[model samples]
Target: MRSQVITGGPFTGRHMLIVIVAFFAVVIGVNVTMAVLASTSWSGLVVENTYVASQEFNGKAAAMRAMASSGISGDLLLRRDVIQYDIHNRDGSPAVVDDVTLTFRRPVGDREDFALALTKTSEGHFEAKHRIEGGDWIVETVSRRDGVTVMHEARRIDTAEFGQ
Candidate 1:
């Protein structure tokens, strides 16, 4: 019985090359998959409403920060008579706020979410025709600017009719 090792040009160094290539393919594939899962918007997983996104919230945050940092003041006025709420971009130019959603838990009812597309009425004024029952509500606004979103919320006593 005899054991012999044969070294050949076609099969000798090629095995190492083949193994390297295969390993790289596997590594690249796994990395790509992980990147997609990890980088893809994590916002959707935060809630059950698959169709809704928090883009507006990001914009609201930018707006809020910009509003704060710029020393440029703006207001969310919940009008006394109409219970009408208004938001001002007030950042000097048109902002990329796509949507504004108001979610609230009334003084007595279960939490409910209402949404409306905000339209810029003027340089910094964004308006929407929304009417709601009066109550102490926690408001959250979802806004999008430059591919990012923000949810800005303000709390208030809808006292326009609370005492009535």
Candidate 2:
């Protein structure tokens, strides 16, 4: 009997080359997609200079502590097309100030970030009409009286929490 040689099976050179190419193609494609998404999502800078920001952290914290010591507090309520902010004094009374600015920022993107000057509706209730989409948002409220910032509050809110 003559010796038999088997060739050109599933393990052929062509098949191996195709498999390797496909594996590398998939990896490169996924990496490219992730890079594009990360680039478009966030700029990755909270402040212009990290060192400067870090230096200012202590001052900011002290300011916040001073504000808290004064017993000034704020509450934020969100609706579909409106945002309501209520400020209170240490005595549980409505704290009305001269100007209240609300800054709305998206957690992931800054494109939709905006600032709204809330109008005084009632004693301590300030409101502004805004069309907020369903997502995570950081709401910053700054209350100024006589050109001095008296109260500063920041809170994170999710539209899904209100079933929006």
Cα lDDT of candidate 2 equals 0.90
Which residue window of length 10 is worst by lDDT in model 2?
A: 6-15
lDDT of each: 0.54, 0.90
lDDT of 1 at 125: 56
- Candidate 2 off by > 4 Å: 1-10
In candidate 1, stretches whose alpha carbon ends up further than 4 angstroms from where it belongs are 1-74, 79-99, 111-113, 159-164
* Worst-scoring 10-residue span by lDDT in model 1: 80-89
Please provide, for model 1 over 3-117, each residue's C-alpha lDDT reduced to its tens digit, 9 standing for 90 to 100: 9988655656679899999999999999999888766523333455634556566875667786455433234555432323344445544444544455554534343445555
